[model samples]
Target chain A: AQSVTQLDSQVPVFEEAPVELRCNYSSSVSVYLFWYVQYPNQGLQLLLKYLSGSTLVKGINGFEAEFNKSQTSFHLRKPSVHISDTAEYFCAVRMRSKAAGNKLTFGGGTRVLVKP
Target chain B: GAGVSQSPSNKVTEKGKDVELRCDPISGHTALYWYRQSLGQGLEFLIYFQGNSAPDKSGLPSDRFSAERTGGSVSTLTIQRTQQEDSAVYLCASSLDRGSSGNTIYFGEGSWLTVV
Candidate 1:
């Protein structure tokens, strides 16, 4: 079985400030990583994904994440956040095997409150 | 639709009553998944389907929860005798085929269930 842990439950940041949300996973086999964001009252939207190659992957809304295999971590980062960035972020992982299918294990989620 | 569609964006039901949530995955998507999100539990995988066949059902929280997919497109999650603890947002997603390269799972807006 695979599991994910998001170290921070909530993070408060000021507008135009940098922010990072940490995520770690435990799995016996290789897996794919993903980051998603859910705005207030909206559905989750994919921020980015890390399947293979280029440990550093970028996504929409100027968000990026680095996949550190040795550390078993996939941390999401944004150089500058806006008021619109205030949302809940989730980290997820899926098994690499076809037999494992498309089931994803998600972390507890980190709520970001970007203030002006 | 351009993305996954879920019905009854919000539902309120009495405890012990049964409720059904529907999901319509993206066209041509062979893999579909169900996830639960709550204030206490965060995000958790429930079930998934591969072309109308469910390979795993253990992720469901209890026997009261059941899901079925027909025609490999629409899926319905049935919660029998719902409890207050079962109140949460149910999210549905769909991917291309497997956990292969460039495969991304798209999510629906989710059906919000409130059991009182």
Candidate 2:
């Protein structure tokens, strides 16, 4: 079974400040990683994904994440945040290859509150 | 629909009543999934359907939860004898899997279920 753990539950940051959300996973087999964001009262949207490429992945809304194989971590980062950036972020994992199912195992999620 | 669509954005029901949530995946997507999101539980996989294969029901919490995909396109999640613990946002997602090539799983806004 694949499990994802988000290190932080809430991140409070001022506008224009940098922020990072940490995520780690435990999986016996190769897996794909993803970051998703959900705004208040909205559905989740893909921020970025790490399938099998450069460890540094850039995503929408000026956000990015680095996938570290040794550390089993995928941490999301934003150079600067705005009030609109306040949202819930989730880290997810799925087994690689067709032999495994496509269900995504998600972390508990990190809620960001950007204050002006 | 242009994207994964779910019905009944919000629902309120008495404890012990049954409720059905619907999902319509993207036109050509072959993979569909159901997940539950609550305040503390985060996002939990409920079920998965890929093409004509057997639906992966491993994530369903208990016998009270079941889901089916009809004609390989639309899916319905049924919760029998719903309880307060079942109150959460039921999220539906779909994806066009391309093996190791990578693909994005799009999610619906989700159905907010409230059991009293």
Candidate 3:
């Protein structure tokens, strides 16, 4: 009952280029991946998280993500981007157990227009 | 309140009047969440508190939407009647006790209901 698919709603990069923001998830069991960043009015802010072991999960400003268990995906990169890294990105999922609670399941966002 | 703290950030209400949004978590952080962001659409899973247990409303979207997390950190989301699609932007998050191992879920800069 977990779902998160953010293929891209808007992504216009330029300054410094290099940006990827795609995510997918359907979850039937293990899950816990996140990458949030909303800066217009400001709220969300955790840039990276992938729960278990490494799957390439950086975070903070440099940003990074790469937990692809067979293809459930969890993309969100940023080799270089500036213009203050225009924001509005999200992709979440949570269900690593705990009786399937902790609620998160998000993804319908991906607006990173860093121009200039 | 060094982080997750929301409250009348911006409310307009009038559709039927009955809004009450407020959250204050981060002191002890025991997991508390409630989301709903609609303007562009994303984060919408409203209800979850993990401390005293017994919350997880399963993503409430009806029953007039209600929430409560009292003696364990402070949370109050009530919307009864107010329609207009219930406006939008009403996020509040917290974590550190949801199967804690690194549970990170801090957010709050929301609360902009405008049910005019």
Candidate that scores best on lDDT: 2
Model 2 C-alpha lDDT per residue in residues A1-116, reported as the tens digit of each score: 78999999999999999999999999988999999999999999999999877999999999999999999999999999999999999999988866867788899999999999
Candidate 2 vs candidate 3, TM-score winner: 2
Better of 2 and 3 by DockQ: 2
Index of the highest-TM-score prediction: 2
The window of 10 residues in a row where model 3 chain A has the poorest summed lDDT is: A96-105
* DockQ ranking from best candidate downward: 2, 1, 3
TM-score of chain A of each: 0.98, 0.98, 0.35
* CAPRI tier for the interface of model 2: medium
For model 2, what is the alpha-carbon lDDT of residue B11? 94
iRMS of every model, one decimal?
1.9, 1.7, 8.6
Candidate ranking under TM-score, highest first, comes to 2, 1, 3
Per-residue lDDT tens digits for candidate 2, residues B1-116, read 69889999999999999999999999999999999999878898889888898888998999999999999999999999999999999999999965542588899999999999
What is the lDDT for B7 in model 1? 92
DockQ of each candidate relative to the true complex: 0.66, 0.69, 0.29
Worst 10 residues of 3 chain B by lDDT: B95-104
Question: How many backbone clashes does every candidate have?
Answer: 0, 0, 0
Candidate 3 TM-score, true structure as reference:
0.34
Error of 1 at B85 (Å): 1.0
